[model samples]
Structures are given as structure tokens and as C-alpha cells.
Target: MSIGKEILFFFGALGAFNGFVLSLYFFFLTQKKYLSNYFLGAMLLALSIRITVTVFVYFNNDLPKTYLQIGLSACLLIGPFLYFVLQSGIHSIVKIPLQWKLHIAVWLVIIMLAGFWFPYQNYPILWNNYLVALIFFQWFSYSLLSGFENRMLLQKIISDYANAVPAEKWFGTIFLGNALLFLSYFLGFSRVPFVSCITGAIAFTFILYLIILVLMHRKRTDDLFVFNIKEKKLNQEEAFVLSQKLEKLMLEKSLFKNPNLSLNDTAKELGISTHQLSQFLNNNIGKNFTTFVNEFRINEACEIMLSNEKLTLESIGYDVGFNSKSTFFAAFKKHTGTTPLNYQIQALQT
Candidate 1:
């Protein structure tokens, strides 16, 4: 091997080896089932195996039959493991349904066929090419399915958790990083490529590793779902009663008019946990706590706008519980599609 090729192989092997180690840590050492450790660990392990196989094929010049078989099997798993990662991360679900085993069954059949179907002696090159094509195609197909699944999952997560931090952006980096790795492989492995696949994949691996490092540096255990449902499902009557009680508390007490209002305080007043309140707002009201409170504040500000012509917009904002003029302006514009001053003028003109 050339000096450059040797270095590439060394780093690539190191990265894949590290990835495998991390996967073990995620699977067995980490005790938190809520973070989707098992699925993540499996996915990482599969990716590590594929990387390892690729390294062996590139430097060695000849692919061994057993190695080819194992690599193809691992590649077959990469996509479904990604799907499992999404499932476990967003919902904290560890036990999959028995029917979902259909995906596994399909992968098994593909592996079985690929393992046995080779007419190795007469058309050796053709079999090798066919296996590579099938493996890449399978990986790409599963990637597409995972992309769709991720979109739907993100929507559901946001819709279901009022307190959910904006995680879609961070999670998107995961998909983009994977795409970079795939592009590297495509360029390196395909007939249509000018660049070396090994080099590109290795470069992308460094980039991906940095991202992983950032994700792991979080102080809290990364629970994707911000709120846990004390009870899984709520009936219509129960939802209505809880919602009504919450509304009464907000309306009667004018809770939104407290400048330092917090979700915890409101939950405490209502005799429920903060997670429960978060669930109520998300599921029943279709609003986050901030949005829910701002609605009432904006409505009160409008009433004051119409009824009291003497108050300044800034003062009226403070009266309606905003801590600062900028915050009030932003919330006013968000809710009413106009600044407070503009809304007052527009209201008078009409």
C-alpha cells in the first residue's frame, strides 16, 4: 500500500473500532432504557461492522467469502436498527410489538438468499458485483424509509410535549452526518465516482465523531421525550374535565398576568405535576405553556388597548405581565400578527 493509503486504513480502522467500543458502552454500561440505549447500541454496532468490512475489502484487494457474508448481513440490519433508534428515542419504547418482527423476517430472507444464491466458480466477478449492489441498495432503501419515519416522529414528539426543547435541529445533524457518510461511500465505491470512497468516508467519520461528542456532553441524560405520560391514554371526558379545571384556574386567577409565571407554579396551584400540566397543554390545548399563557396576556393587552387610550404600549405590556418591552412586542406580533402599537392604531382606524 502507498503511504497515503496506509494512513487512511489506520485512521479508518481506529474510528470504526472506537465506534464499536462506544456501542458496547451504550448497550450494556448505560442503564437508562428511557434514552433508547439498546437500539442506539445496536445501530452503532451494525455501522461499526460495515465500516470494518469496508476497511478489510479496500486494503486487502480480495474479499473473503465469510467476510462478505457477514458484512452483507450487517448491512442488511443498518436501516431497521436506525428505525428502532427513532422509535426508542422519541417514545422511550423498548419492547417492540410481535408484528413488527416482519421487518426482521424480511432481512433474514434477504440474508439467507444472498448467502446461498452465489454460483461462485463460473461467474465469480458477477456474484461479487451483485452482492455489493444489493447491499448498497438495501442500505439506501432503508435510509429513505428512516427519513420518512423521522419526519413523522418529530412532528408527533413536538405535538405531544409542550415542554420539549427544540431537538429537531440537533437530530437533523444526525441525518446529515449519515448522508455525508453515504455520499463518501457512493463516490468511493461506484463506477461513476472520481474520489476515493475510503478517503471520503474517513473524512466524514471525523466530522460525525465531533457531532457525536457534542451530543454526549449533555449534563442531563438525553431523554428525547420531555414529558412522560403518567397514564398512557386519556378518555374524552377525563380530558375535558382536566382541561376545564385548568382553564378555570387560569381565567379566575388571571395567572397569565403574573410577570414571573412559571409552569411549575401553575402546576402546583392546580394540584398536578408539571409533566401533567405540560401534557394537558400539548394534548388538549395544542399549545406550549408559553403559548398558552401568551394567548391570555395578548387578549388582556387588546382589551386594555381598546378600553384605556391613555396608557403607553410599554406600560401596558408590563401591566399584562411582560418582563420587557421586546418580549411583549415579539409575543404581540406572534399572536396578533402586528406590534402592540400597530394593533392599537389599526384597531382605531377601523
Candidate 2:
């Protein structure tokens, strides 16, 4: 190989090599097993595998067909992992949902079935002419979808780059990097004379180093990648408005009476995310979701007991939303500093 080609190959191979090692570090060496980190690991692994193959094939015309198939198969995974990495970080998804699992399973099945039915060794023409297009399409489609889904974050970074948090800026860099890398490969695939096929690998090397620079500047890449998703904190004005709304909804809807009410359900009724609602309750109200809801139930129970001396303790418990007598008595005592029976008696005497 010429010296120029050798130098180009060195940088490209270095990027792929570092990426593979980083993927392993994320997968097994990280102290915390965050889902976002796991997705990031998978994304890096897929990109490294695809780029390694690209670099080799660009240099060697006689590379084995098996390597070609492996590279394309890894290419199919890159887009999905990219989408998942962004989403899992943004949405604070700690666990893999069933639908996400099913999505991955479906993609895996399709790739395996295709490879089994038309082995690249036996049907090189079919793989090259038709399957390659399909693979690239899938990769492009998911890349576009990922950007569309996370456009708000991108816009935030663009509008306020100076004040944007490290996590937001990190996310934006990743999205833009992926887009550029995809464009580089797409230009090569389109047979643009100016853009050589090896540009993709070179672009990837630059992108990877750029992302490393971002991590270095932040000095908190650990927190960012692990996705300690900073909940959107409410300002004083927003907090007051949400607090009032929460009280109004609770009083009007009597949501605590349902007995099956959950933090998620209450957050939905208040038109806020669960995390925001939880933060509001804990930080502003000085109570957790369970304690807050129980307070309401206990207050209502007291009102009922005072209004109607004819009701039994167990009956009053059920009337005010407690599903079990023991739970009702326990909460009543906790809030009032007396059992339900004692409180009722004290109230009647007063």
C-alpha cells in the first residue's frame, strides 16, 4: 500500500480499535449498570465492527465474503442501538421494556433468517445488489427517526449553547456526529466521485475523537453516559402553579379514594412527568407520593368519623378509601397521633 493509504488506514483502524475497547469497558467494567450505558456500549460495539470491516474492505479487494456478511449484519444493529441509546438516556429508562425487547428480537430474527436463506458465500450478487440496499435503508431510517424523536434536545442546545448542561450538549454532539458519519457513508454508497468509500472510516475516526474531546471538557462523562437524568426542576413560579393544581385536582377528583391510585396516575392527572411530580412532592411538599396520598385519606377519614358517629371503625376505613382495616388504623394514628377509635371519641367529646 502507498504511504498515504497506510496513514489513512492507521487512523481509521485506531478509531475502531479504541471503540471496541470502550464498548467492553462500558459493558463489563463500569461500576453502575445503567441501561443507557449498556445501550451506549452496544452502539459502540456495532459501529466498531462495521467500521473495522469497512476499513479492511476498502484496503483489500479480496477480503472474505464471511467478513462482508458480518459487517453488514453489524451495520443493521447500529441504527437501533443509536436510537435506543438516545432514548434510554433522555427518558430515564432504567429497565428494558418489553416492547424494546421485542423490537430487538424482531430485527435479530429478520437478519438471521435472511443470512440463513441466502448465504453471502453462495449468493454474493443477491447480497450485494439487494440486501446491501435494504441494510443501508434500515440504518438511514432509524438514524432519521432518532433525530426526529430527540429534536427538542437539539433545539435547546442550539438556542442556548452557552448555558446548556453537559448532558444536553453531549447528547447533541452524539446526534450530530452520527448524522455526519451516516452522510459520509451515504455519499460513498451513492458513488459520488468526490467522496471516496474510505471517507466513512475517516469520518468515524474524527467523530470519535470529537466526542472524546466533549467528554474531556465536561469531566463528568461518567454521569452523562450513565444518565443520571437531571429532572427538569421547577422554578418558584412553576412550582407554585403545580402545587396549586395538585391540591385542586386532589380535592375535586378525590383521587386518593380510589385505593388503586399510583404516583404515575396522579402525575398523569396533573399533566406532568412522574419524575417531576415526585420531585415536587418530595422537595416542595416534604412528602413522598405514598405519604401525601395517605395524608389525604386520613383527613377524609377523620371528617367522616366526626360527621357520622353511627359508623364502625372498619366501615369508616372503607368509606375513606383504605382497603384494609389495619392500614386505615395505622395511617389514622400516624396522622392524628391517635387510633381511629380514640380520635373519633375525642372529637365527639370536644
Candidate 3:
């Protein structure tokens, strides 16, 4: 083959190869086992399989029909996986829902049965002409649904790209990449003279790299995929009751005095799930657990400093539930905008 064709093949195949490795990394090697990452991994695996077949077929027209069938079968999953990636990421799903499991199971059965009934080796014409179009349309439909899932982010990206969150933009880029990839394949399927199946593979290579660049540029690789539950809305009455109960409990029991106080421990004390307590702290009080607890600690620390000027800051930090003097100083600076010594001096003068 000429150098130009060899270069095209190398670039196209490299994307699929790297994508497959990354999928495995996310699936079993990543330390954090997030559901969103699982879906993203699955989507990558599907894309790699499809793109591999496309590249091979573009270079070799006589590729086995069974390989084409397998590739197209993988194509059927790309859309659902794409949707799940967005849905799980946006919703912060911890456990895979039953509906999601069932959705995938049903699709798996459908494709398996189709392959069984109409083996592509015998029905190449139908698979190539009719089923390929169906697969592409299905993929496109999922792409649209994915857009709907992230509609707010898309609007933000379009209206105020400058201010949109890095994570949101990263996700939007993935959706746009998928759409552009579909366009490339659709053009080839339409028998556009200059476009070939390999065009989609080439486009995917560029899209894949662009996605990686966006992820790296934003420095969101860690936080973006980390599973933090979507904050739930707490109504005013419930919020008021919870806040009062929490404050009273903390004041009466001094739970924050424990240096190792945890969200789970506090939630158990409050007779609520950790999720509810987190929601209350985050939404109603506009403070995370640490900040809420630190406020009490800082208040007590200030009172102690005023009562006995001879007490050392290190002792005061431990007495006030901080695990270390440095943490106490940092939190104090963050909440009070002053060092412990400066705060004490200012208070004495006042």
C-alpha cells in the first residue's frame, strides 16, 4: 500500500486500539468504581469494535461478512451506552438501576436473536442495506436522547460558553463528537462519492483525541467521574425541622467535638440516611458536613481563646475537634478570614 493509505490505516486503527485499552482500564482497573465510568467504558468498547471493523473493511473490501455483522451489532449498543453515560453522569447514579439492566438485557437478546435467525453470512445484502440503516438511525436516536438529557448544559454551552462549567463542556463535547461521527458514517452510507466507511473511523480518531484533550485541559479527570449524588431539593418545612434538630443535637451532644466525626455517624444520630443529612447540609444550610461542623468548632475555639488567653493554639485546635493544628488554622482562616492569633488579638482589642 502507498504511504498515504498506510498513514490513514495507522491513524484509524490507533484510535480503536487505545480506546479498547482505556475501556478496560475504566472497567476493572480504576480505583473508583463509578456507574458513570462503567457506562463510559462500555461506550468506548462499543465504539472501538465498530471503528475497528470500519477501518479493516475500508482497507479490505473482501472482509468476512460475519465481521461486518458483529461490527453492526456492536453499533446497536453505542447509542444506548451513550445515553446511559450521560444519564448516569448527570444523575449521579450509585447503583445500576433495574430498568437500566433490563434495557440492556432486552437489547442484548434482540441482537442475539436477530443474528441467530438471519446469519449475516447468508443474508449479507439485507444486513448491509436494510439493517445498517436501521442501526445508524437507532444510534442517531440515542444521540438525540442524550442531547435531551443534557439540554441545560447544551444551552449553557451555546449561550455562554465562556462561563459554562468545565465538566459540562466536557460532556457536551462528547455529545457533539458522537453527532459528528454519525454524520460521517451517514454520509458514507448514503454512497457519497468521496466518503467511505473509513471516513467515520478517521473522524473518530480525531474526536477521541479532542475528548481526551478537553478532559486534560480542564483538569477535571478526577472530579468529573467521581460519584457525588445529585443534590435533592428539600422543602422549607422539612428543611426548617431538620436544621433545628441538627443544631439542637449538635449543641446538646457536642457531636462535633469528636475529631473523627463522619457523615454516616452524624446521619445515624439524626435518625436519617446520610443522603438526607447531606442534602440538608448542602441545600438548606448551604454548607457541607465539614463546614457545618467546623462552624461549631470554631465558635467554641473562639470562646475558649477569649476565656483563657494562656491556652496554646495547638491545644485549642485539638479541644475544638480539629485533628491537627494546621487543619484548624486553615478552616479558621477560611471561615473567619484571619489566623487564630490575629483573631485573638483583634478580639482582645475590640
Point to the candidate with the largest TM-score.
2
* TM-score of predicted structure 1: 0.64
Give lDDT tens digits, candidate 3, residues 11-91: 999989878977887799866788878998899899999999988988887988888888889988999998988888767
**Which portions of model 3 show Cα errors greater than 4 Å?**
214-220, 226-229, 232-350
240-265 in candidate 1: lDDT tens per residue?
Answer: 88888878988899998898888778
Rank the candidate models, highest lDDT first: 3, 2, 1
Q: If scored against the real structure, what TM-score would every candidate get?
A: 0.64, 0.65, 0.65
**Cα lDDT, model 2, residue 297:** 91
- Give me the overall lDDT of model 2: 0.82
- In candidate 3, the residue pairs with backbone N, CA or C atoms under 3 Å apart (3 or more residues apart, or in different chains) clash, namely none
How many clashes does the backbone of model 2 have? 0
Tens digit of lDDT per residue, candidate 2, span 1-350?
99999999999898899889878877998766878778888988988998999899889979888888988898889899889989998888889999999999998998899889988999999988998899889999999999899887787578546434456667787778778878888788889988976788888888788866765586345546643445556688988899889989989989988877877788889887555676677667877677788898998888888888888999878877789999888888888899988888788889
The per-prediction CA RMSD against the true structure, in angstroms, equals 6.3, 16.9, 12.6
